[model samples]
Target: MMSILGLLELNFSFQLVSFPAVILKRLTFHPDDCFEVRTPNLASLGQEEPWTPNTLSLRLDLSDPSDPNVSISLYFDPGTRPLGLLPGSKILLHNVEHKISKRKNVYCRFINTSVLTVISFPPSLQKRITTDETSFTRLYLRDIRGSVQGMQQAVCSITRISRLTLRWNCIWCGKLFTKGRCAARQEGFCSSDCGRFGASASVVVDDGTAESLALVEAQQVAVMLGLTAAEWKVLKDEVWMRGELEYSYNQQFHDPVADPLWNVVAALCCKASSFRRFNLSFCLKKQLHHQDVSEKTFQLGEMRYATQLLSSPVLFVKNITPSDWKALVSHWQHLHEAEQSTH
Candidate 1:
């Protein structure tokens, strides 16, 4: 406990590394198949020394008695973390054989203490969970070996607590991560802002509006880039909230409504182009790498002709010859005038 408080006060941090060694000793209670561990010798606490035990404890003790007032206790299950110990390391131990007879079970007596400076995961070739892969927790275990000699209880005494807080961390990013904001919110990103890259990504969205918008925009962008419905669907739900479109439309009707008007204008514009006769060959010869020609890539072939007129997009100014814009407006005006005459 003294050691822990001192560590907290000093803001001590250690570099953890894994190395292969041996468990010199271990004591298992055959009835429950659990083990108890303690410092095996005094000479083993050297820097970079590995920890070995005849019996490994389910808990570890890390209190110091040099000063008596401030101390701390931490409890952990076996296989909770990879096992390695360097000089200055602490361990919490529990004696399961000496539980008190009461409505509640209480642990007592000191087994041993290890003088490891650090603990860390052991190296393995198996790839850990990464963000690019499917999001889920996969099980893993690492073999660790280190040597440390624990001191006697008279040197430092620590009382065990009923429970300890365990941190849940991101499997990929290795930071504190959690779920549940309010009762109303659904789970995914820790918060809505994180979903949108807005703030620090800590607030949760109770309503699904933000999520729905993101999904729709991803789908629309997929369409504009010539993606199939199935292909778009595969990536639809994987976008951020801020990237969503500002408007909403019925998915069933959107395709039918937007296609015709765009097609007519695009066809007229393309026909007016010097390259109209080469349209089929031009499309076929378009650089596939540069072309958004997926099976469902947006069918905006007509608009392609019109966009070609715009230049200096940075200036928001049309780069086409004045005659081209004038012709387009005049053509629209003529259509309007003809419709009025018919009416």
Candidate 2:
């Protein structure tokens, strides 16, 4: 297996070789470059037009297994792009072209004759890879407010949901529009006429120690609510009707109307035994570790730890069992109480 570093250092072109790497990110291709040519209406009249095969240009950020720190951008011009290509996917590149661009950036390109293979790791190996890449620790929302960063795991409750906005984006040009025609079509750049609807809502979450606002993206919201975009649109009237009925019930007993339409929806979604506890992973901008602070205590003990407020952090929410939630909560409470006593 060729290493990405060694591949870049090659002075001459080589062939019939393979390199194993993990994908870090998928870059977007230009609308014009990936768009397919539409068959003209005059073709029905027996006017033969030259056929142009649609081609794909995909760019991926890859890291070599030999040296995870070393990463490089690779461009693919394959006849057909592989499906299920995502970040953290392992792949093997065969007979790729190594070239330096005008900006002096070393990158690899996969030509028409090149081959790409998606490889899967064994269950044991996959677990090991995840453990090696991630450092897990239990922390409260208050402790995470400043002292920690990077990927954080926490359990929080939704206190408020607001600013729900729904919109659509052109699949080709990725232009966000409320309604009407896509900008790409107006400019004659795209003819696919494909668009996807997405919705976002601002939510305030509480974990006892502190409350923070998080902007839940379309995917997270959909997963948490167990409702697709289409379902959300279809059930809008029913949801409002249910909300009004609940409000009337609360009024009859003189109870507080704390749960609104979205709030009730969120609460009902979480009522499922599986969704009782959610393991949320948040990617923070700044990176810090407790061991680093301990090691450099004398050098940086007096430094104030500033809270890095989360601004649209990517969240991965997973359901955890009640026993697991209890264990984590107990550990967090003990630590939080100890810290509070000292202060």
Error of model 1, residue 130, in angstroms = 33
For 1-343, candidate 1 gives per-residue lDDT tens digits of 2233434332333211111122222222222445443443223222211322213343433334344344432333332122332213332321212233264433222322211222222122112222221222222111110111121000000011111112333344333333412212244533322221111101010010010001112222232223467844433232121122111111221253645432332232222221110000000111112222223122222422111211100001111111222232233344445556787
- Tell me, by lDDT, which candidate is best: 2
For TM-score, the strongest prediction is 2
Weakest 10 consecutive residues of candidate 2 by summed lDDT: 122-131
Encode model 2's per-residue lDDT on 1-343: one tens digit a residue. 6788876764645543468888776654543565433322211212322111124356778899777899988775533344324555577776566777787677887664454655642121121111222335544554543455456676555544444444566677777432444656767776655566665655555543344555566566665555667866654444323222221112222223753454554454334421233445665434334332321111113433232323322233332212243343234344445556787
Off by over 4 Å in 1: 1-38, 41-49, 52-56, 64-73, 83-87, 90-343
lDDT of 2 at 267: 50
Candidate 2 TM-score, true structure as reference: 0.33
lDDT scores of the candidates, listed in order: 0.24, 0.49
